[model samples]
Target: MKYPNGTKMIKSNYKDNFTSKQSFGNRGMTLEEDINATNNYYVETDRAIIHKKPTPVQIVNVNYPKRSAAVITEGYFKQASTTDYNGIYRNKYIDFEAKVTKNKTLFPLANIHEHQIKHMESITRHGGISFIVIRFALYNETYFLQGEKLFSYWNDKLKGGRKSIPYQAIKEEGFFIPFHYQARVNYLSIIDKLYF
Candidate 1:
C-alpha cells in the first residue's frame, strides 16, 4: 500500500494566505464596528436584538445644497447619553456602555459619566442586566465588566480612591471576551455564562 504524502499534498502558499487573511480580519475595526457586527449577527441568527443607541442631537442650522444633500451646520446634544446600547436578550433587558481606551495601565474613571453610572444602577435595581464593555486598544483586549462590580469602583473613586481602574484589576474582575467570526465581540457568551 502507498502511504499518503502530507508534505507533498499541501500547498506551499496556503499557510501564508490563511495567516494573512486571519490578520486582516480584525484590521482597523473600531469597538463600535465589532459590537454592531455582533449585534447584527445576533439579530440575524435569532439570538438577540441589540443596537447602538443614537446620540440625541438637536439641529440648530441646516444647509441644503441639493435635495439629496442636506448638512446640519450646527447642532446641540439634547441631553447626556445614558449608555451606548440597550436591548433584550433571553427575556432579560440588557443595558451597556462601550468604551475604547488607548491607555495602557488603567481605564480613566472620567471615561464613564456619573449619569451613566446612575442609569446602569437603575437597570440593575430593576433586575435588568447591566454592564460595560471596555476595550484596551493597546493590547487589543476586550473585557466585560458587570455594572454591579463597576459600582464599587465608582463609589471608591468618589470617596478619594484611585481615579482609574488598574488594568490588572480589570483582568482579575472582568471577563475577557474572545473574538469570533460570526459574533465579533461575542459578549452574549459571557452573558450566558453569567446570567444563564
Candidate 2:
C-alpha cells in the first residue's frame, strides 16, 4: 500500500488470520451487572418483574454549581439494606441477595449481615421464595443457595462451627446458574425447577 505522501508501506510477517479461543465467561461484568441485565431481559419479555433494591440514602448536602448540574456532597444510609433484590416470579414473591467472592475454597459467612438473615427468614416464613446468589469469581460460577440451607450454616457458625461454607458443599447442595446471552444469570430457571 502507498501512503498519501508517496511512501511505500512495508508489510510485516505478523499472522493476520490468527484467532484467540473464545471464552464463555461473563467477560469482566460484575455479578450485579449480570443480574441486572438478566432482570431487564425478563421484564422485557414479560417473564418476571425484578429489580435491584436501591439503598435508602439520606442526602444531607447537595451542591448546585449550575442549575442543570447537581452534585451530592454528603449522604448517609438511612437504614441497613435487607437484600440486593426483590420481585415477583410466577405469582410468588422472590427475594435474594447477590454476593461476589474471590475465595475459591469457600464463601465467607461474614459477607452477610445478621439483619439480612432475619429478613430472609421472615420472607421464607411468609410463603415467599428467598435465596442468595453467590458468585465465585475465581471459578466464574454462580450458585443459588436456598434460604433454609443458608440459615443452617449461619446457625452452625454462631454455634462455634466453620465460619465459611465450602465451595464443594455449595456445588452439591446449591443449584448452579449458567450464563446465557440474554439471561446472563439465569437464576429463574432454578426457581422454575424447585418452586414451579
Candidate 3:
C-alpha cells in the first residue's frame, strides 16, 4: 500500500524481530500504530476517550461457502472521511487528524483534503479543539499543529502560495510531542499544555 506521501509501504522482513514493547524507535513501528497504542493507553488510564474512526466501506459483493463464514469479495469507501481521531478530553471535544511523511524539509499540503480542512474549521467554530498530528518519520519527531495554523497554510496555498509547509515553520508554530514508554506519541501532554 502507498502512504499519503506517495511512498509504497513494503512488508518489512524485520518486523518479527520487534515486539510491541520494543517498537518505539524510528524504524520499529509506523506512526499510525504508535498513535493507536498511545490512544489505547489513554483509554485504559481514563485520561481521555479518543478513538480512530473506522473507514466506512461500501460492500459490493460477498461470498459464502456452504456452512462457512462469509467473505467480502468487493467493497469501496463510502465517502471521504473528515479526520482520523476524535473524542472528549477534559470535558471538551477533541478532534484531529494524524499524518506521517518521510520528507525532512517540508510537509506537502496535498496530504490534507479540502473537506477535512473544512471539517476542522467547523470543529473550531463550534468551540471544540481541532488540530493535526504530524510525524516526520525520518526524524522521529511528532508535532501538533493547531487547526487555525493549518488553515493559514491551506488558505495561502489556495491563493497561489507555497504548496508545502516548511519543517522549520512547523517547528516554530507546532508543539512537539514527547515520546514516552507508556504513551508512545504522548500527544495528550501537548493538549494539556495548549488546550487545557
Candidate 4:
C-alpha cells in the first residue's frame, strides 16, 4: 500500500504491481491518518497524551538477511481494535474513535461497528470521556459525537425506520470540533464546553 504522497504505507505484497488502497478514500488521507498526525503533533508539543491503539500481530515466518535485521514474511492480527485512540489528559482517561465518509447528507449509523459501541459504553461506565470524531468529508466539517448521544441515536434508528442520522440532528446532538494547526481535532476544547 502507498500513501497518497506515493510513500509505501503497509508491508509490500508479493505482486510487484499490486497496491491496495493505503488510506480510506475520500480527500487525500483517511480520518485515521489525520487523527494520527494530530496526535503526533500533540505529543511532540507536550499538549496531550493520546496515542493510537496498537494492534497485536503475531509473526510466523521471518527471514534474516546477512548482517541485517529480520523481515516478517507472514503474520496474523489477533483481533479488532476497540477504539481508534485513547490516553490520559490532565489525569483523565480519554477514549474515542475517528471516522469519515464521503456522503454529503448524513453519516450512516452502520459505519460504527457494534463492538466499538460496546467499547465506548465500557469507557463511559468506567467514568472516562468517550466519544467519536466524525468527519463529513464532502463538507469538510468534523464533529465530536459523545458516546451516549451516539448510542441513543443508534438504538432509535435500529428500533424504527431511520437508516441514517441527519446532519441537522448531528449538528444538534454532537459538538462541532474546531480546526486548529496544532491539535487538529481540538476535541478537548469541545469537551470542556459540553461535558467538563
TM-score winner? 3
- What local distance difference test score does each model get? 0.85, 0.86, 0.85, 0.76
Q: Give per-residue lDDT, candidate 4, residue 72.
A: 89
Candidate 2 colliding pairs, count: 0
What 10-residue stretch in candidate 4 is worst by lDDT? Answer: 14-23
- Report how far residue 27 has shifted in candidate 1, in Å: 0.9
Check candidate 2 and list the clashing pairs: none
**Over 4 Å off, model 4:** 1-7, 10-29, 55-58, 76-79
Q: What clash pairs does model 3 have?
A: none
After superposing candidate 2, which stretches have Cα over 4 Å from the reference? Answer: 1-22, 77-79
What does candidate 2 score on TM? 0.84
- CA shift at 25, candidate 1, in angstroms? 2.8
The residue ranges of model 3 lying beyond 4 angstroms of the native Cα positions read: 3-27
Residue 170 displacement (Å), model 1? 0.6
Question: Candidates ranked by TM-score, best first?
Answer: 3, 2, 1, 4
lDDT of 3 by residue, 1-196 (tens): 2235434336642353243333335347777777888999999999999999887889999999899999988887776668889999999999999987778899999999999999999999999999999988667788999999999999999999999999999999998998887788998998888876
Q: What is the C-alpha RMSD of each candidate to the true structure, in Å?
A: 12.8, 11.3, 4.6, 5.8
Clashes of each: 0, 0, 0, 0
